[model samples]
Target: MSDLLRLATAGDVDDGKSTLVGRLLYDTKSVLADQLDAVTADSALSTPDLALLVDGLRSEREQGITIDVAYRYFATPRRSFVLADTPGHVQYTRNTVTGASTAQLAILLVDARKGIRGQTRRHAAVLALLGVRHLVLAVNKIDLVGYDESTFTVMAKQFAAHAAGLGYPRDAVTAIPISALRGDNVVDRGGRTSWYTGPTLLEHLESVHTAPDPDQTPLRFPVQYVIRPRSAGCPDYRGYAGQVAAGVVRCGDEVAVLPSGLRTTVAGIDTPDGRLVEAPAGQSVTLLLEHDLDVSRGDMITAADAPPALTDEFDATLCWLGDRPLRRGTRLLVKHGTRTIPAIAQELLVRLDEQALSLCGQPGELVLNDIGLVRLRTAEHVPIDDYDTSRATGSFIVIDPADGSTLAAGLVGADLPIQ
Candidate 1:
């Protein structure tokens, strides 16, 4: 099987994100015949309206704008893709956060006529905050601008500088000029503007390096269940079952159970497929430990050599998604990995000015779709890692305890700008 690449689309409305996604699926032959036929039947133009393939909602089709995140899966000979076509409306920026949370790369679309809008900058900042290292600036509608090389060049330079300010490395960002409606530089390199030499969007998608390898990072496995089978054949089987969040775990390796600080050894690795010698990140397996400590759900199993610190209070950067404002002293639930703990919004540090790409001191409260830094106090000690070290172990969601609605997506450590 080919390696998978998780990516998302972002930018202002009418930038043709849905069209671009639909174009990709269409050109790659990933769309089904019935789906294409339905779109073709609904289309009023000479050719089939590709955007209809992704804009599935009735409201979206009527308004010709994306309001929700639409996910599409496709595969090429070299790689597989999970593409998230995120919303462009400011109110739906929270949905962009959701779509890009697990994305390894983001394609920030921009209309050639209107270079980069404020929402584009905001989405870029959010992508940076989420640790999406790779980016592709798809400058759409080049045909409307007469395929001017200067237009694409100027916009690419501006975005490159902005991405640098956001801490993206030089090679992490790529610029491609294309007309999503015309299918230029999308799947294949059409003979339009021979001035451009960059790879097509599909080629780039197939070859670019993806997110960091979880198996190479520190071990972080939060036990979801303590498997104790009472069957007649195996009466003494006690294994901790959960997905490996990061790093690799091998049988006989020394491990540490968090919150209790108990040391143990991995006696064996169990899987439904049969016993295994080792398991890497992203694998769901049962770990049989040498010592049966009081490990349970919410307890973390980590490599003994480098275990996370137990903490009740920690600073985090929040992408507030709540409909209501997030004020200090508000009680919330912090769901990290397999554990959920009661926490309070102890302090609001600063809010990000996405357009200005700067911090706005300390805000009284974080409003809807606000990205801010805050301090949180948990009711119990939880093992947490910095997002830079482990994306799985360092990220969490803030839930409204009253209604259980998710309020914000949080990164364990703040990625703040230098004042």
Candidate 2:
């Protein structure tokens, strides 16, 4: 199987994110004949509206703006891709977080004519906070600027400086000049950018190494379901089923059940294909314990020597998504992995001035699309890792109890004082 690459596109509104995504699909021949025909018929110009390949919503098509996250799947002979085309509107910034949270890389577009804007900085800051390590500063619409190398050079330098100020390593960022509409350097090199010698966008996407080896991290397995078979074939079957959040699990490895602090050994690891001696991260398998001592859903099975910290309260950075403002003492549901617990917004610590990459004075409340640091108090102790350590165990969502609407996305330990 070809290695899978998960990436997301982000930028200010009308910066050609959707066009870039559509161009990638079209140039790769991922779009069907019927879809291309429909897009061509809908185009105002003689050429087909490539953006229609990704902007599937009627509202998006009519407004010519993407409102929600649109995911596209395509594969090359060398690699497979899961691309998230996120909205560029400030109000829809929360959707960008949703799209980028799982991505290993982010492609941040900047219009060659307009240069870097406030929204561009805002999106970059959010991506950095979400722990996106690899960044591509795509200086798009180069054709509009007469494909000038100097224009690309200036914009690329400014973005690199800003990204460095946000704590991203200089080597972690790559700047490319492209025209998503004209298909320059997106999939096939249009050869207009002869002055630039960097690899094409598709080349970088195919070759970049982003996947972390599972064996290097500590184990984190949150039990999603406790399987108790009642069938005659397996009357005494008791298995814990969940995707390994991190690290590896072997048949005889010692494990600890979190919050309960019970120790056990893995008796067997079973998958739909049958029993296995071990399993790694990203695999969903059932584990049989040597001694069952009351394990349930929401409980975590971790490496005995490297268990996550259990805490009832912790500081977190939040991206407020609710229409209503987030204030102190507001009750909400904190959904971390498979566990949902009642939690209170204890205090609003500080708000991020995204443009400046600094903190604003402590805010009394966080309004819609606000990024801020807040302290939360949960009703029970929850196992959590630092956001920088493990994305799966350190992230959570704040949901409204009344209507079940998601209010915020939280990253644990994101608010730690800069050292």
Candidate 3:
């Protein structure tokens, strides 16, 4: 099992994501004494407002809402955690995407009173598109609904069905009742509901397995830098420095430099500690090739036998995030891996209707927070993969060249059904 777990909390506004995170931090004894003291002193209530611990922004605290992705780190004896508390408002759905982009799991909260809302379904669809494998449906504020067990059960079944329709397996979704404010079933299984006999939120987080082993996937190493330091100990050291995005790389493995399709053998793997005989996915190392090639940043090094396709055109699912509307012929930059290329929105196929949980037939333009299917044409052929096959190689960002701001988050070859 991996020692670190990356997760995110998301839902509608006032869903208590911050409070849940703060409770996790507090109950796990992860907060510093001075930090606790400050929050305690700042609170007007008898007890410190736990939400203040995560709602760090003055605007968020003042408005009593989360507007950005707030990341928190804490640990228990069993494992460490990095949780992103994402904003829930419809306009800030982009932040939720940013927060959950790399998360292996997501805690999708629902008010026991509201049941399943449109934004909830939309967020669930976006999580599916992002390929987040594990999901926890946290039916929060059960106290508001008089701690009705049937209400929780009905919501869980409804969400489970929706998640299933979105391609999540039965075992991938787990539902738990929680009250972030009261600290029930968060870190501990409180006595409020003896009718429920499931693990606490923290217990589930600690035990749940997530994501397939990256080492089992094909090798994908995008060269971030080329190292050729001329030193006394190593006068002729030439290596490609990058993080192994997927699969295992061994010393003798034959690798292919992408776009150029130049083949070479892995001469060795070097790190700051020393040379390594083999390096697996997620490890950053300097790769020594048998033959020196014109490798640079944006070029990918992959297993020679299973190289990704080089293409100038591909279909993508885009989450439109720009303040201005997006339409066909909108010239933008597609930042894939480390490569940036000029691209145009060739066609806007359809937009996702969050209310109906279906695709809009002929949406000509996409506004902020509108997710749609688009055909992108790049200026040059770039190495890309299917998102379901390799997230590291298949994801790209659409950026506005004028202001150098990100306009959209894209997934290559993923046209997920909203339903």
Candidate 4:
């Protein structure tokens, strides 16, 4: 199997995010001939409109803006890619958060002429808060600015400082000057940016470590479904089915079920491909335990030595995506992994000021697209780990009780009360 890398792009509107994505696809010859023909026929200009490759929505073409997160998949000789083209409008910040939540690396675009804007800063802060450790500040549209080295230098320093202030390590952040429109430093190094001698955007993406190896993390497998075969051919078959959230598990490994504090040994690990000696994170498999201890969907199975905390109340940080303001005592359903439990917005904590990167004095409620620290109380005990420890077990979403609309994306222990 080929190595896969997941990444997302974020920046302010008109920062050429869609165009950059289009250029990557076009330059890499990932676009089909018919798709290119359609774009060419649709374009009013002499040249084909590359943005049309990704801006698939008719509304997007009509308005000339990206409103939803568009995902594209392609591969090169070295690696395969799953790229998310996120919207840049401040109103669509929720989309940006959704796109970057699972991204191992993010390419944050900035208009070479406009340095880092408020929305850029907000996106950067959100990426860092979501635990994305690798960042590429792609300073795009260099052609419009005369390809000046000083321009790139100044903007690079400013963004580096902002990323550092937001708690991102300087070494983890890379600033690349490019013109996504002209394809400079995107797929190849163009002559215009001779002064900027750095790896191209593609180079950094191919080389950056996606995330900590799953085998190095603790085991966290949230049981999704219980499998029990009643047929006479396998009358006694009982297994727990789910995707391994983190770490590795093997037959005969001692495991513990969370919330119930029951312990069992792994009797077997099975898949359609047949029995497996071991399974790693991201693999979907069924596990048979030595003793059935009432395991069900939503219960977590973890290595005995490193079980997650089972708690009903904890402080969490959330990116409020609800239309209605989120105030204290708001009741909702918290969906963690495969488990859905009644929960209440126990308290309204501090809200993060995107510009200042500081907490605003206690707010009575969080409005749309507001990133705030809040306390949540669940109806039953749920197993969880800190967002930093394991993204799989540490993140959750709040659903509106009345309509089931997703309201917020939450990270456990994202923000602790000021000391």
Index of the highest-lDDT prediction: 1
Any residue pairs clashing in model 4, and if so which?
none
Q: Tens digit of lDDT per residue, candidate 3, span 1-419?
A: 54899999989999889989999999999999999999998788989899999999999989989999999999898888999999999989989999999999999999999999888988998898898889999999998887889999999999998888887899999999999889889998878778899889999999997645644578899999988787889878888899998788999999999899999999999999999999988899999999979899889999999999899999999988899999999999999987899999999988887546677866789999888899999999999998878888889999999999999999999866554
Residue range with the least summed lDDT across 10 consecutive positions in model 2: 410-419
Order by lDDT, highest first: 1, 2, 3, 4
| Candidate 2, position 199, lDDT | 85
Q: Over 4 Å off in model 4, which ranges?
A: 209-214, 416-419
Model 4 per-residue lDDT tens digits across residues 133-185: 88899999999999989999999999888888887777899999999988999
Q: Is candidate 2 or candidate 3 better by lDDT?
A: 2
What is candidate 1's lDDT per residue for 85-177, written digit by digit as tens?
999998898899989988999999999999988888889999998988799999999999999999999999999988888888899999999
CA lDDT scores, all candidates in order: 0.92, 0.91, 0.90, 0.90
Candidate 2 residue lDDT tens string, 282-400:
99999999996899999999999999999999999998999999999999999998899999999999998777777776798999877899999999999999887888898999999
Residue pairs in steric clash, candidate 1? none
Better of 1 and 3 by lDDT: 1
Model 4 TM-score (2 dp): 0.94
**Each model's backbone clash number:** 0, 0, 0, 0
